[model samples]
Target: MAFAVSGYEGGKTVDFRRLAHTGIRLVGITRSYRDGVLSFEEGLAKNVADGDQAYFDVLREADAYIEENGLPFPPEPGAWELLPDPDCLTNPILSLDLAAAGITTIIWATGFKFDFGWLKVNAFDEKGDPFHKRGISAESGIYFLGLPNLVNRASSFIYGVWHDAKYIADHIVLQEGYMSYAKP
Candidate 1:
């Protein structure tokens, strides 16, 4: 029940086993095919076990990380328990209908908030949050950095911060046509 990566609480490890005992399941969404459109549907079961190429690739990388970091995970069974038949694994999506399950309330505890009250522009969505493509606002020179999913899921991470900074720098240079801007 251990997660491969957990970065909650400013670097504190949570007891997921205890959480699981309380019927708290840690789950992730299966990658959806957008066909060039950015969209995802609730409970979309598009990927499963061995048929999911992305899953296999990520599993391989996680295994490598676990080994390199000398994690306590057992090597024999490894990080994931793969069954002989893919069908044996329960469907990634357990239930999609929350109302049917007697669900009357949902509390979104997403531990992130945005305060863009200072930015006066039309680069915002109905939710009052700045909507941009890879941090580039619709308005010129108004770029957002270190936002969640701004460039990808890791955009707020330290590694992502540096990567995004470089991307924004390059984008500014290209947009402004700064021929003297040197790249190291």
Candidate 2:
């Protein structure tokens, strides 16, 4: 059967037509006229047809990594358990226990968060807020990097990480004046 599908912008339409001529049937246009909606089925179909096994392989590898690292859900749960410094403290219970055990200098590298629900301050909006325009949180002596919209709207890209890193370094330096570094 012959079909004339439309609405796809750019080279995708041409690519689809070329692929269709090669025995691939143009069943239907997948995308919607509305914005922000993605067509997963169509994307999957295209990936399968194109023999793009790399995508699925990466997903499988990520799943395996999560499983092996005891991060069955969020994909990297216990991956951070073995910190490079191993001096940083995370869990409050563990921190208290360690404190009781006479350990000091609990370095917390729990990473960044998009949600600010823990903060009782007005730093958050009606919804939990981003740390900065990027995705930093409001914990004292804490720094964040690699967040979306750190500098510009599109600062989430790899190029923008430098900007975020610089900001974090500056903040760390400034925090040194008010923050004391001693063993707990």
Per-residue lDDT of candidate 1, residues 14-105 (tens digit): 43333444665433342342333222333322333223444456568878999899898865453344333222122334334554556566
TM-score, every prediction: 0.45, 0.30
Predicted model with the maximum TM-score: 1
Global lDDT for candidate 2?
0.44
TM-score of 1: 0.45
lDDT per residue (tens digit) for residues 53-84 in model 2: 44334457778887888874864444222112
Q: What is the C-alpha local distance difference test score of each model? A: 0.57, 0.44
Question: Model 1 Cα RMSD, Å?
Answer: 10.2
Worst 10 residues of 1 by lDDT: 37-46
Best by lDDT: 1
lDDT of 2 at 162: 79
The per-residue C-alpha lDDT of model 2 at residue 35 equals 38
Off by over 4 Å in 1: 1-15, 18-57, 60-76, 81-110, 178-184
Tally clashes: model 2: 3
What stretches of model 2 exceed 4 Å from their correct place? 1-124, 131-137, 180-184
